[model samples]
Target: MAALCPNDFKPIGWLCRKKRYSLKWKLCISMIFVLMTSMWINPKLLMSMLTPVSEYKKQDITPVKNSKHLMVSAFKDHRINGSTRIISILNRGQLQPLFCIFCCGKNNYSTPATIDMHSDHFGFRYVTTDVLCRNKPKSNAMYVTLSLKPDVLYNLTDFLPIQNQIQEEEAFPYEFTICISSLFGSYNNVLQFVQTMEVYKLLGIQRVVIYNTSCGPDLEKVLHYYSEEGILEIVQWPIDQFLIPSRGWNFKEHGGDIHYYGQLTTLNECIYRNMYKSRYVLLNDIDEIIMPYQHANLHLLLEDLQQEHPNVGVFIIENHIFPKTQFDNSGQFNRTEWKKVPGINILEHVYREPDRKNVFNPTKILANPRQVVQTSVHSVLKNYGQTFRVPPDVCRIVHVRVPLQSNLTKEQLFVDKKLWEFEKPLLPNVDNVFKKTGFLN
Candidate 1:
C-alpha cells in the first residue's frame, strides 16, 4: 500500500508478526495492554497503584505506644493558647530528646517539646510528664507524634476534640464535675460508688469522670448504667499494660515503676479534659464525697466562696475519715434492702475521726480547672490565682474507709452528720440505680 490509514493499522497484528517486534517490546506492549485493561475495568485500581505506600498508612491511626519507656496517654490542645500538651508517663531521671511532630496531612512541623515531669511523682521510677509544644504560626495541625526524630510517621495521638471552646466565664456545660483517678484493684465497691454518685448528683454535680484501670463486673454494670444516663464518663485506663504501677503512693515502700497507677497524669488529664467543659472540678476518690456543710448545695457553696475569696482557683477541702468500722448508733440509714450490696453503706458511717495533733491532714480539691496548671492528689502544684483552704465547717470530704485513727475509740470520733443531710434524695436515687442495674432485680 502506498499510504496505510491509521485506522487500518493493527498494533496487535503487527506485534504478532514473526520477528516484527523484539522480545522486550513485546513484553512492554503486553504490560501496557494489561494495565489499560485493568484501568478500564476499575479506574480506582490505577489510582491506588499510583499512590505511595506511606500515603496508604495515613488512612488508619496507629496504635498508641504503651510498652515504650515513654508512654503518652493523651494529646490536648491547650485552650489558653494555641499550644499542644501531651500527657505522658515516663521513666524518672531518664533524659530523652523528645520532639513533637505536628502532622498536617502529608506535611509535618517538628518542634522541641519541654518535658516537665510532675513534681508529685513521689520518687517513683516512672512519673507523669507534660510535653508542651508551642504551636507554629498559621498551622492547621490535626495530629501529634512524639519521637526522638522529627521524621516519625508512627505513634500519632489525635488531639482530643474540644466540645466547647469556652471563651466566657459563663459558657461552661457543667457547673460541677468530679474527677476520680485510676480506679483499680478490681474495685467492686458498688454500694459506695453508687452512694458517692448519688451524693454527687445531690450536690449539683453534672458529670463524673472516672479513670478506671480495672473494676469488678458489678461495678462495670453500674458504670455502664451511669454512662448511659449521661452522668458518668468512664475512661478505660490500662496503666498496668504500660508500666509497673504501684498500689501505694510512696515508691520506696511500694517498689513499683509508677506512683498510684499514674494518678497524677489522670488527674491532670481530667482537669484539661474538662477545662472548657466544667466550671469547677472536684478531685476526690470514689469513696469520698466533697460535702458542703454551710450551703444547701455545692453551687451555693461555691457561689458564696468565690464571692468572699475572689480570684481563688483552688479550694482545698479537708478530708475527714468516717471510719467504716464504727457506725452511727441510730442506724437510721441501715436499710435491709442494701444488706446484699458488696460495699460499705456510706450513710451509716457518720462518725469522723478528730484531726490529728501537729500533723498535716490530707485534703481534696474543688478547683477552677482553667486556672490550674499542675495538680497533685491533695492540692494543685501550680495555678494562676490564689489557693483557698475551705474551713471544715464550710465544706469537707467525707471519706468512708478504714480508720485513720485506729487507736481512738469510737466514742472519741466526732459525730459529723453532714452526709446525712442528703439522705432523703440519695437513698431513692441509689435505689433507682440499683433497680436499673439489676442489682435489686
Candidate 2:
C-alpha cells in the first residue's frame, strides 16, 4: 500500500473531510429509507399508514351523522336482535340521507333487512322497518336514531325511537277505537266534530284518540270534556314547531312539510299504541264515517265479518261522497237545536255522488290494531293478515264533504239513508255533548 494521505482510501462519493448535506435533504433521504424499510417489513402496514392520506385526498371520509349527534343504526350481526315495529320515516332533509333504524326489542324482527323509501313530488323519502317481535328469551331492546349528518352520536331514547314490546294480551276498554291525526292550528268544525263523534259512538266505538296540534278554544272545551270523561285520548301533536308538515295527502299539489300533517306517522303510532289494547281501530277523517247499512252496529258487522272471513285483519270500507250540497228534503225531523251549529248536520246529507267508472274512491279502514303494521289515508299499507274490501251493500263510508266531482245532476246522485238509523240516538247524543261542552247554553 502507498503512504496514506489524510483522506487516503476515501469513498468515491465522500469529500476530503466528510460528505455534507442540508438538513432538509438528510431528513428526506432518511424518511425515504424508513418508508422503504417499513414497506419491506410489512406491506399491509405501509398501505394502512397511507390509507388516511389517500382518503383525505379523495375527500370521501365524510362522517355518517351531523352535529346534532342523533342516534343512527350500527351494523352488527346480533344473534338475538329482533324486529322493528311502527317504522315510519321520521324526517329526511335535503342535506341528510334517509335512515331506517332499529328502535325496538331484538325479538321484533324476523330477519335483518334494509327498508327502502321514495320521495314524493318534493323529493322527500320515507321508509319504516317492518317485523313483529319474537319475544324470545335473552332478547334485548335497542334504539337507533337517523342523524342528518354522518358520524354523530346521539343520546339513547333522545327522540323516543320505536320500541316494539312483546305483544301482551292487554284488555282494552274500548271494543272499537278511532284514530285521527294532526288536528292542527286552532281548527274548528264543531258541528262536524260532534256529529262524527256521535256517529262513532253509535257505531259502537268506545274510545277516540285524536292527535291534536291545536284547536279552537271552543273545540278545546269539547275535547277537554271528552278527555275528562275518558272518551277521547288527546295526544299533543305540535308537529309544526318540529317539522313543516304537509297539509294535503298529495304532496305535489299541496306542498307541505309532511303528508297530510304527518297523518301517516300518527296513524302508525296509534296502531301500535292501541295494538294490544283495542280489538279494532277505525281510521277515518272527522267528516267521514264507515256507515254499516245492513248491520245495526260495527260490532255486529265486524262479528259477522270475522265469522265469514276468519283470517281477514282489515275491512276496507268504500268511500261515498255525500256532497254538502245535498240536504234532506223530507221534513220528517228537524235539527232545531243544531241549526245554530256551524257545520252541516250529517243527518240532512243523505244523497251521495254516484261512483264514477274507473275512478279510485278513497277508502277508510276498520282494522285489527294488532295486525296493522302501517297505514295511509285511504287503506292499509301493510298488515299481518288478509285485507278484504267490504261490499257497498254491507257497509260504506258516509263521507260528508264538498263534492269532489263537478257537474252532478240530482238524478245522478243516490240517496244513502244508512245514517238515519242512528239519527234518533245520535241527535240526543250530540245535544248532550254540546250541552256538556257548554257549546249550547
Please list the C-alpha lDDT of all candidates, in the order they appear. Answer: 0.79, 0.65
1-441: candidate 1 lDDT, tens digit per residue: 233226535345334222256799999999999999989998877765665433433311122333344544334455547677777776766667777777665566789878888888888877777878776777756556567766665334332222222345678889999999878999999999898888888879999999988999999999999999999998878778767889999877998888888788889888888877899999988888898898989999999999999989899999889999998898788889998888999889888899987989999999999899899999898898999999999998888999978899988988888877776787788999999998886
| Best candidate (score: lDDT) | 1
Model 1 global lDDT (CA atoms, 0 to 1)? 0.79
Q: What is the lDDT of candidate 2?
A: 0.65
Instruction: Please provide TM-scores, in order, for all candidate models, with all chains considered together.
Output: 0.84, 0.71
lDDT of 2 by residue, 1-441 (tens): 333336434444343344467799999999999989978987765654444322321210112243311121122112235444323343343323434333343222223334333223243332222323222244453434343432333222232333434445566667998888668767878888888888887778899999887888778888888889888998776656545666766667777556766676667667777776688998887777887888888889998999999999998989989988867788554567777766667777878898878988778889987776567667776668899999998998888889887588767799878877876787778898888877687
Question: Which RMSD values do the candidates have, in order?
Answer: 6.2, 14.9
* Candidate 1 TM-score to native: 0.84
Model 1 ranges with Cα > 4 A deviation: 1-68, 71-80, 153-169
